[model samples]
Target: MKNIKSLLLLLIITSFGFSSCQKDIVFVEGSGPGGTKPTTYTTKMSAKVDGVLVECEFAYAQQYTNPDGTKDIQIYGIKSAQSFILDFQNFKGVGTYNAADLISSGTYVSGVNDPFNNGHYAESGTIKVTTYNSKVIIGTFEFKAVNTIGEIKTITEGQFVISLEPIPGPTPGNTTTNITAKVDGVATDFTGQAAYVKSTLIGNVMTIVGTNGVKAITIAIYNYKGSGTYEIDIDAQGSYNEDQSQTGSYATENGVKTGKLIITSATSNTIKGTFEFTAPNMVSSLSTKKTITEGKFDMSYTTTTM
Candidate 1:
């Protein structure tokens, strides 16, 4: 009994001494599925705003490699109709980065009604690159952004892992074949060896450019990532430009009268589709309306991956 009491007293003293010499520290990690450690290069992120769960998506043009070997890595997070852009510039490898300035800092908004009205700028933030390699890129970030309406949001515990690859280009035979269409009841065929097809993804939008002989056509689809029927609008649709002039005669036009694009196949590096639209020449005083039909395009083009 006496030995037990002494042992208890010694344990009490030791516990007190240990507690006195102990220090407490806290570590906050990124939140989400596989946030702490990512196994693959798939752009994904999650954060918290005002103690509420906020989920965000990484944009298509999330990463870009400059000619000088510097890399511009950007990640976008959207939650509750609000969006933010975290821009990390001149980042080549694993290291710490500061928000630097307006250009490099994060930007945010309540909603993006127009493509031109992107969002507001981030006043401050910090990003730590945890992983970077040919296999994958991972990072954690936190920032504060204010909208144009003077609303501020604190983005916290942000982390992302995205697949990395060099920018892609159209296949060798992308422009070798002939692309046929009808314009204003006139049969048109874009042919020749110099003819080329180019497709680019900006954010969620996709723009396909095709040029043959003296005619060039540009088609844009909003939120285009897969096969679907996309409606055409006036301010942002299809156009045909006459390149005969030295200055190039321009046509600011929109799709009218049952204008639609039907995408049949979409892959990582290829897209095939058909389209029909009525385009009006906005540059001319007459506003000449051109009916485009029987349009078909099959091209293998590359994209800039995140």
Candidate 2:
């Protein structure tokens, strides 16, 4: 009887221990019975906005190489009506970056109406990059941002795991292709896929287009010459389209010769230039214009005989 009781007690203890171990075992996202680990992970960003946790449904990172070989990195995430953005100038790999340094900054956008113009800019913050490489970027950030109207937000506990991919451009062996300008005093970065350069086989004509996914700026030069200033007149033209449908379009008046394009360097495969133009609204009968200034582009081109 004593041996039987001892064996039963041992079995109960072993059973309890096995149950506890099973409970403690945690499985990964796809490590269940019929699932396998995903080869690629999705980009993720999450943060607490004034104590409320929010996760971004879409997130992306873009790196732009400047003419001086410095790198500018922009990380963006969007969740519902809110958006978050971080800009790092002269990025030098894994390290802690502060917004007070004036080279790096953060932005928070709320509401869907006029998000671009109504967003808040970071007044103070710190971002610690734990891992940064060609494949991925992992970081934690927090900021105190203020809007134009002085509305403030405290964003905290921010974390991101962003996947990086090469940006395709016309340039061979070049991964960075972007155009930046100031439109009516507002800074704009044209880094979308639509930004490109196309030239004729004879190399007499060229058209360059850049967009920020919302607005597009186009420059067409006729009788193209190397390293020279071109007038925005009959020989060269400029246009600004506000939307994809191009319902609201603006163009420089022909023969008016209001703006100029200065080609600093024009090579067989690449072109570096600066341009500025005043384009009047073509869609509206009323007289309105957009001033594009400090425009710069360093891009490769694809030549066609047709």
Candidate 3:
């Protein structure tokens, strides 16, 4: 999840523009589940383009708390650069809203394609709020949107379950001063005697990078901020900063040496984790695979927002 925070920020601006809006809208419901209620927040959207059925999966969820005591639910579905955004203002009970009703409220903005100046508008559609609580929101939506060039796209089967509660922070734990591991059966250590270990946690992802002289290793865990084992995301996991891009550098590979990130503990200001990976030389001609094992880290971090 590289630059995910940036991506979400852009999405907030292009999708809803919460800050520039008018009076707030609030959605609230009592606790406990009713009969036949869903247990999760899930969403999907699809349509037919050029006689081919194209489905866009729900990609992200964001909730904006307004100063006027109102809230906005922002859901995004993406199929390539083309996308759709559904904004539910003051999302309350199980109610149906048509295009006119939603537009009149000025809290609704449903559209397709790029959401910038060149975006499209939904000519007609309905948004339904099935159920909601402080923890989750469940809803369904459909729209017939057209672009400025007079291109029409029908979006259907749109639904989502967005979690609204805050994520739990890590517990209290001791901090270690060094990171120890082995590279291809050779002992490797980063005692923090020369350089400090740097760590950053944003959303559910945590990234850590350490160095010793010219050798550096980076480890990242996605969809994770708690104690658990996670398989590396091959495309955006970690890298070995050696080789100086000569013959290319090395990356964590799935097979051959298989990579793993194990987070033992976490807190708002501290994190502890272990990792291992079979770093493959990006340049295929370089046959050496750096095996990093028994890797460990315990570091403190600070939070920053943009």
Query: Can you give the lDDT of residue 267 in candidate 1?
Result: 81
Give the candidate order by descending lDDT: 2, 1, 3
Least accurate stretch of 10 residues (summed lDDT) in model 3? 193-202
lDDT of 2 by residue, 129-247 (tens): 99777667889999998887788889899998786753222222234436778988998777422112222322255667665544777787766766899999667888876653323
Candidate 1: segments with Cα more than 4 A from true spot: 1-42, 57-61, 78-80, 100-103, 114-118, 165-218, 221-294, 297-306
What TM-score, over all chains together, does every model reach?
0.44, 0.44, 0.38
Task: Kindly list the per-residue Cα lDDT of model 3 for residues 40-77, writing each as its tens digit.
Answer: 33334444443455555334545544446665555655
Higher-TM-score candidate of 1 and 3: 1
Local distance difference test scores for all models: 0.53, 0.67, 0.52
* Cα deviation of 224, candidate 2, in Å: 32
lDDT of 1: 0.53
Better of 2 and 3 by TM-score: 2
List per-candidate RMSD values in Å.
22.4, 24.1, 18.6
Model 3 alpha-carbon drift over 4 Å, by segment: 1-58, 100-118, 166-306
Taking the tens digit of each residue's C-alpha lDDT, what string does model 1 give over 59-151? 222455455667676655444345555676776578777763733666555543332243555667777778776545677777776655666
